[model samples]
Target: MSATVAAILVLAVGTYAFRLVGPVLHGRVELPARLQELLAAGAVVLLVALLATGALTEGGAFAGWARPVGVLVGGVLAWRRAPFLVVVLGAAATTAGLRAVGVA
Candidate 1:
């Protein structure tokens, strides 16, 4: 398998193994509420971090001005209940305009 696939499999299997271990080791599954809360919070944190990592980065740097402007254009168009094509056009238009004007 490719390194990326192997890494993904390892991570997935390791996570499942650890999660399953809790129940297997302790037949009486009675964890405190706080621990559960922390785990849930950690999951949310991980999700947010993953999203931010993609939405807030580009080409080895932060997402920078043009990308956010494109996203905002798309969002505004979407907020106005524009169609999918219009929203995509809005983002494309915004990105093209910004780049033409050297906003990046």
Candidate 2:
């Protein structure tokens, strides 16, 4: 097999193993309450970091104001409990409108 294919196979197996580990250890391992809370907070932090990275950067540089503003609009709508479709459309429209007006 080609190196790329081999690498993909390895990664697939690794992902499957990781998925298997949760169910296999579910009842056998008990985490402290504080640890659980910390884990949940860590997950939120990681997700926010990922969102910020994707929204604010493109190809290792700033993605300009349009994309981030779009993301912010989407975020506000989501926080307001708007429907998912509306949130998506709002963000896309905000970005497209800004781009159309030569904002970026």
Candidate 3:
């Protein structure tokens, strides 16, 4: 196999092994309450960081005002419990409409 393929296979196996360990040790290991809380907060922070990065940047540069505005609209709709399709299409439409009017 090529080096790239071999590396991919190794990574796949490692990922599966790590996932398997979680279930195998789930009830056996006990985590402190503080550690669990920290993990939960860390997950939220990581998600927010990812969302901000994706919404505001492209190729390591600013993505422009249109994209972030679109994300804001989508977030508001989602928070209001709008349908999933509506949230996605609304964001897309908002971005496209802004770009169409030369806002970006």
Query: What is the lDDT of every predicted structure here?
Result: 0.85, 0.98, 0.99
| lDDT string, candidate 3, 5-24, tens digits | 99999999999999999999
- Model 2 regions more than 4 Å off: 1-14
Clashing pairs in 1: none
Instruction: Give the range where candidate 2 is weakest over 10 consecutive residues by summed lDDT.
Output: 95-104
Question: Which of candidates 1 and 2 reaches a greater lDDT?
Answer: 2
lDDT of 3: 0.99
- Model 3 ranges with Cα > 4 A deviation: 1-12
- Candidate 2 lDDT over residue span 1-104, tens digit each: 99999999999999999999999999999999999999999999999999999999999999999999999999999999999999999999999999999997
> Evaluated with TM-score, which candidate comes out highest?
3
Q: How do the candidates rank by lDDT, highest first?
A: 3, 2, 1
Q: How much is 32 displaced in model 1, in angstroms?
A: 18
**Alpha-carbon RMSD, each predicted model:** 6.3, 2.5, 2.0
- RMSD of candidate 3 to the true fold? 2.0
